[model samples]
Target: MSLEKIKTVTLADVSINNKGEYGIGASAVDYSDELYTYLRITDINDDGTLNKNDLKSVDDVDAKNYLLNENDVVFARTGNSTGKAYYYDKMDGELVYAGFLIKFSLDSSKINPKFMKYYVLSKDYKGWVNSMCTGSTRPNINAKMYGNMELILPPREQQDFLVNILGEIDNKIEINKMINKNLEKTLITIFNSWFINFENYDNSKGMKIDDSYGEIPVDWSVEMLEDYVDFVTGVEPGSKNYHEKPEPNDIPFLRVGDLGSRDNGVFIDPSLSKNKILKYDDIVLSLDATIGIVKMGLEGAYSTGMRKLVIKNDNINQPFLYCLVKSNRIQRIIETFATGTTILHAGKSIKHMNFVLSDKKTMDDFGKIGNPIISIILTNLKEIEYLTNLRDTLLPKLMSGEIDVSEVNCDLELKYNYMKYLFNQIHTPMSKSVV
Candidate 1:
C-alpha cells in the first residue's frame, strides 16, 4: 500500500447528502426523566469521546427532527471547541444533538466514519481549524468550510483494519473504566456498611443509644471535622496572569471541573502564586457549584473551589478519611451547609459540622483492609491513563499512515504486557500510612 496510491477527497464527496445536507441541531432543553438524550458541544470531550454522564435530555417530540443515527458524525461549530467532533454510534435510546453541533451524514462505503472521526480529532484538524476559523471574540467554522476540508482515503479494507485496531483499544479502555467504577462502588459500599451503618463490624443487636444526630456506635465519639483534619483552600490567579500553555516546571492546576475524570487536567505555571499544592493520594474536596465532590488523583496546585484535607492525627487513616468525606451522608451534610445560589460551601459551617470519629485502632485496622483495595483502584487508574495515552498517540499516526498496523504488533496480550511494564515503572507509590 503506497501513500501515492491512496485517494484524497473533500468531505463533500463522501457524504451521501447533497453539499448543504449537513444540519445544525436543535437547542438543548432541560433534562426530563423520560426524554431523548441531548448532546451539546460541551458533551463531546476534547478527545473525541462522548461525556456520557453529563448528558441533558429533551422531549422526543422536540428532538424528532434532530434524532441521531449510527455513522453520523457531529462537529462543534463554534467557540473554543470549534473543531471537536464525536462519532455517534447506535444507542438503545433516541439521541438528539444540540444547536452548537453540526451533523455530518456520511456515505460509509467511500469513507469509514470511525476513521474520519479520528482524523477530525487529530492535531492536523486543529491546525486546519486555527487557519480557517474566524472571529473576534470566539472562533467559528461553518458547514461550507467543513465540507471543503479534505481527507485521505485508503482502500476500504485498510480503513476497516485501522478502525478495528483502534476500536479494540477503545473498547479495552472503556472496560477498564467500568472495572474502576465498580471497584470504587464496592469500596464505598463496604465503608458505608462498616462505619456508617455499623452493620458489617457488629450487630450491636441489643445495645442502642440516642444521640443528637441519630443512633450511636457506643464506642465511637462525634467531633468537629476540624478536629480530625486540617484543610487549606487554593487561590485562583486571574485569567490575565494564568498560563494556559505550561512550560517546564509547570504544575497541573486542579479545579472542581477536573474532578469529573481521573486524567482530564491541565498544567499551569507553578511560580505564579502561594497557593497550596497537592500530591498524589492527597484528599481534595470540591467546595463550589457541586459541593463535597472528592478526588485524590494528580499532583498540582488546586483551584479556589477545592480544598486539600490533611488528617490531623496520624492514626486517623487518610484512605478511610477519604471514604468518610465522600460518603453520601457526609456529602448531604455538606450540602446542608452550602449557601448562596451559586453553590458556595461555607468554611465556618464545615469547621463546625459534627463528624463521627472512630477509635484510632479501629480506623487503623480498617485502613489495613481498605488501603489494599484503594491501591488496586489506583493501579487500575494508572493502567487506564496509559491505555488512553497509547490510543491517542496511535490514532493520528494510524490515520495519517505514519505508522502501518502491519508493522505494529496489535496482539492484545503483547500490548497489555508492554503497558503493564510501563505502568509499573512510572506509577507513583501509594502512601503506606495516613497522610
Candidate 2:
C-alpha cells in the first residue's frame, strides 16, 4: 500500500519513531560536567524535562553504544513512571539512557520527533497508558508494546508545520535555560574569587587575616546564621490539600522534587498554610533525600522538607546568602545536620548553623557584583515559567486538533516573537555583566 494512502501508523515502523533498544542497566555514578549524563526514569519530569535535582552519570568502557543523539526519544517503561517520555535535544548535551528506559530513534521524514514526544505526553496517550498498564501488578510497558502503539497520522508537511511552530517555543525556552546556566556559573566564579579566595580585595581597604575558615579579609567577622537570617519551617498541610491544577487561591506548594527553579509541580490551597507563603527572591533549601540544594526565584508555599530563609535585613546580602548556602563549606555543614541513612533531615537544626558575616563594605561590593548575576538568573527563570505556561496551554489544544496548524491567527507567534525579543535583550548585557 502507498504510504500516502495510510491514515494511521504504528510507532514500531522503522520509517517512524523506531530503532528501539532497552537502556543500559548500569548503576548511576555522581553527575560530572565532563561525563555523559545518565538518563533514568527518575531523571525525567512529567512535562519531559530532565529532573535537575538528582541527575547522575555513568562511565563505562562500552559507553559508545549507550550514547544518545538528537532525534532520539526515551520512554520510562516500568512502575508508576510508565508513559513518561523525553526526547534528546542537542541543547541537553550527551546522554545515555539507564535501565527501565526505552529509546527510539525518530525519523523526521516519517514523523516529527518533537510531535511524537508530545503525543506520548498527551491526554490520549495517558489514557492509553492508564488502561494498558492496569491489571498488571505494577504499571509496565515494554518496547514491543511501545512499538505497537498507534498514531493517527497526519501528512508529513502538516507534521513538519506543527513541529516548526511548537519547536520554536521549546528552542527559545532552552536557549534561555542555557543562558541562565552560564550566568549562574559566572556568579559562582565571582563568588569563589571575592569570598572564598579573597582574590579581589582592594589592599587599600583591608588585608587577609586568619579566621576559623582559613583566611578572610581583616575586617570581616563571623556570626551565628540566625542573627542575619530567620529560617521558616514549612508545614505538611497533607497530601489531601495538594492541588496539581491550582485554583485562583492555590499557590505552588514546593517539595524536594521541585528544586528546579522552585517550579510548577504541586500547588496547595494557601489558606491551609497562609503564614508559610513564599514569594519571589526567597531562598529555599531542600534538607531531606537530596540534601543541600538551595534555590530561589519562585512564589509558593513550601513543604516541611524545605526551609525558607528569611532575611532580617540588608546586613546579609541576599545574593551573597544564596551563594553561601550553595558553597561547599556550608553545604558540608548542612549535610552533617541530617540524621538518616535513607532520607536525611536538616530540619530545625538549621538554627545551630554558623554564618560568615563578611564585612559590610565587602558584602556591599559583592552584592553589587552578585546581585545582577542573580537577577539575570531569576529573570530567566521567570521567563522560563512564562514560556512553559504558554506552551502547556497550547499543547493539548494543538495536539487534539483544537488549534489547527494553519493557525495563521495563532497568538503563539506573537508571544513567541516577544519571547525572542526578551532573549535578545537579555544575552548581551548579561554576558558583559559577568566580567
Candidate 3:
C-alpha cells in the first residue's frame, strides 16, 4: 500500500461550518424537551452512533445553525475524547451539535459514507488523530488539522463493494438488535401484566390480601429476600498488582463498568485460577455511583467490588430474581436506601434490606417466561459479536487489497433476506388464542 497514493482530506472541506469556533458561547440558548434534540459530546458512541439518552433540546437560533442532518458525522473536536465520531442516521427534527463536537458530511460522489465512518474509527486513523491533538490540559483537534490527514482512497467501485459487504453485516447486527429489543418488550409486558398491573387474574375492584408485609393478593404470599438468598460484596484486587499478560489469560474479573449497555455483562482482566470465579447464571448488581442496575453473569470469573452485590442463587430462579430486582418498585426502594450528600450512593447494607418475596411457584412461572427472553437476548448479542469480529477482520484486508472481493462470493443479499425472515419469525405468536 503506497501512502503517497492516498489523498489528504481536511475536515473543513466537508463540514457545514468549517471555520466555526470550538465551543458554543454563553449566548447559546437553553434546550427544551418539546423541541429539537441537543447532541453533546457524550451522545456520540465510540462505534459511530448517537446515544439517545444523552440527547437534550435547544431553542437558540445560533445553536440551531450547527444542527445535524442524516448522514452528518459529528466528531468530538475537543476534550479527552477528541476525534471520536458519530454518523447521524436518524433524528426527529433539527438537532444542535454541542461546541465540543465538529460536524461534517462526506462527499458521497468520491467516498462511501459508511466506509469513511469505519475508516475514521480504525486504529490507524485514531492513532494519527491522537498524535495531532494539541493542548496541555484539554487536548483538541481543529478542522484545519483534521482536513490535512491523508486516507486510502480505493476506486469508487471497490469502495462501494467493500461498503456493501460491511453494510450487510451491520444490517444483520441491527436485525439482531431489533429482535433482542422485541424480546425485552415481550418480557416487560409479561412482568407488568402479572406483577405490577395484576392482569393475570380478575382484579376489577382493586382487591387486597393479607401477608407478612400486610396487604397483598390472597393468592400471593410474601417472604424476606434474605430468606431466599445471600448478598456478597465485590473486592477490588488493586491496580498495583494487576498484571495484563499472565493473569487475564486465566480467570475472568469484572468491574462495575463491565455490565454492558445492551448485553448481559463483560469480564475485565482475568486472573490465574478458575476455581475462585463467578460462574454462569449468577446475578450481579451495581452497588455504587449508579446503583441497582442488575445483570446476570453469562460467562467468566468476575471481581466482587465493594460496590457490587453478588446474589447467591439458592434455588430461586436467577433470571426471575434479576427481573424483580430491576423492577421499578425495587429501584425506588434502592433509591430510598441510598445515602450520600452530593451524589447519592447505594449503601453497603442494601443487601440486608428485606423485601416481599413471591412464592416458588410464582417465581418459577416468571422464570419460564423470562428465561426464553434472556436466551434470545444473549443469542442476539453473541451473533452481533460474531458479525462485528468478521467485519473487523475483513475491513483492513479488503481495504488494503490483500483480500480480493472478486474471489469471495459470499451471498450477502441472501443472508439479509434470511436475517429478515428469522427476525419476523422469532416474535410470531405461538397460537391464535395467545394473541
Candidate 4:
C-alpha cells in the first residue's frame, strides 16, 4: 500500500506513442470469412468489452496496419463517447480499430497494460477526463492531451496482483453472459418454430381461415395486446431522490439504458420509488426516445422511458408475451406508431397493437417448454448481478490499497494445488471401457 516507491509519469513516458494510429476510413465491408474484423466505437460496450456478434469486417488491403495486438488499449476520442477505452487481448483475434479511437500501447517494462486499463475506470482518471472535456459543444480529447495526462504508477508486482484478481472476476462474468446468450437463442428458435411458423402443427388437423391481417389456422385467433396484458408506464423520480450506492433494502431503478448493459443502473429508495415493481418474465418496452426496444424483467422499478407489460389474463403466458413484444413484427408495429422527430414515443400506439395469438392450450404447451428456459436466463442474470456487485465492491478498495491483496497470489496457488489434488483423487482411470 506504500506510495513512497511509486513513480509519477505522463502517459507518453509509459506508452509506445503519444497518439494512436488512425483506423481505416469508410464503413466496414460485409462480414466475410476472408476479411479482417473491423472494430468501431459502437462495437465496444460501456464496460470496455467488445461485442463479438455485432462486429463487421474490412478488406485486407492495408488492414494489417490497423490490426490490434494483445495489451493494446483503444480509446474513444470523439463525440459523446469521449474517453471510453477498450483493451485488446489475445482472444479478440485479428481486429482493426476505427479512426475515432486512439490506441495506447503501454511499455510493459514501465507499466502493466492490464493495470492501466483498470486505472482508467478509477475516479481520478474520470475526473481528469471531465476536466479536459469542459464547455465544448463536441467533446473530443486529442492524442497530445491524452499522452500528457499524469498517472501514478505502482511497482510491477503490485500491478500484477491487482490485474490477476480483477481479470478472474471478469472472466467469470463473461462466462455467464455467454451462457445466457446461448439460452436466449435456443428459446427464440423454439418460439419461432411453434408460434410464428407453425412448423410443428399438423396441417391435416389445422383448418385455414382468412382474417383482416392474413390467413391463419381456424383454431388460432388475433387479439390486441391490451386485451390480455396490462401495460403500465414507468415512473421518473427526480435525480435528487436517486441513491448513488444501493441501500440494503432499496431496489435497482431500471432505465432504458440498463436493458443490455453489464452494469445495473442506479438504485432508488424503495419507499420513494412509486414505479410498478417488475417480476420475472414481465415484458419491458422502451417507449420513449429509443422506441420499440424491449427487455425481459429482472425485478426492478423501471424508469419513465420504459413500460412494463403485466399479464392481466391467466390465458396469456408471461414468457410468450415477453417474446411477442421483443419480436421484430411487434417492433415494426411499434415503430410505425412512434411519434416525434427528436424524441420518439410509443405509448399511445402500442396500446392498440394487434398480434396473432394461439389458443390457450397451445400457449400452455409453449409455456411448459419456454418457462424453464426463461427461468434459467433469469437465474443467470441474478448471478451476473451478484458478480458485478462483487467486482464493483473490490475495484475501489483494490485501487486505493485499502485491502492488501499481496497475499492473494499465495492463496490462489494453494487453492489451485488443492484442486489438483482433489482431481487426482476422484478422477481415477478405468482399466477397460464398459462398452
- TM-scores across all candidates? 0.82, 0.84, 0.79, 0.84
Q: Residues 275-332, candidate 2: write the lDDT tens digits.
A: 8866777888887777788877767777788889888998878888888888887887
Model 3 lDDT, residue 141, Cα:
75
Alpha-carbon runs more than 4 Å astray in model 4? 17-19, 25-35, 52-61, 212-215, 238-251, 260-272, 297-299, 408-435
Between candidates 2 and 4, the lDDT winner = 4
Best by lDDT: 4
Best by TM-score: 4
Cα displacement (angstroms), candidate 2, residue 100, comes to 2.0
Q: Which ten residues in a row have the lowest lDDT in candidate 2?
A: 426-435
lDDT of 4: 0.74
lDDT of predicted model 3: 0.60
Residue runs of model 2 more than 4 Å from their true location after superposition: 1-6, 14-19, 27-38, 51-63, 91-94, 203-211, 261-264, 405-435
Alpha-carbon local distance difference test for all models: 0.70, 0.74, 0.60, 0.74
Q: Candidate 1, 67: how far from true, in Å?
A: 2.6
Better of 1 and 2 by TM-score: 2
lDDT of 1: 0.70
> Cα miss at 393, model 3 (Å)?
2.6
Taking the tens digit of each residue's C-alpha lDDT, what string does model 1 give over 185-276? Answer: 88788777777787754545343564755766777777777777877888786566555556576766766767763334556677754768
Model 2: what TM-score? 0.84
**All candidates in order of TM-score, best leading:** 4, 2, 1, 3
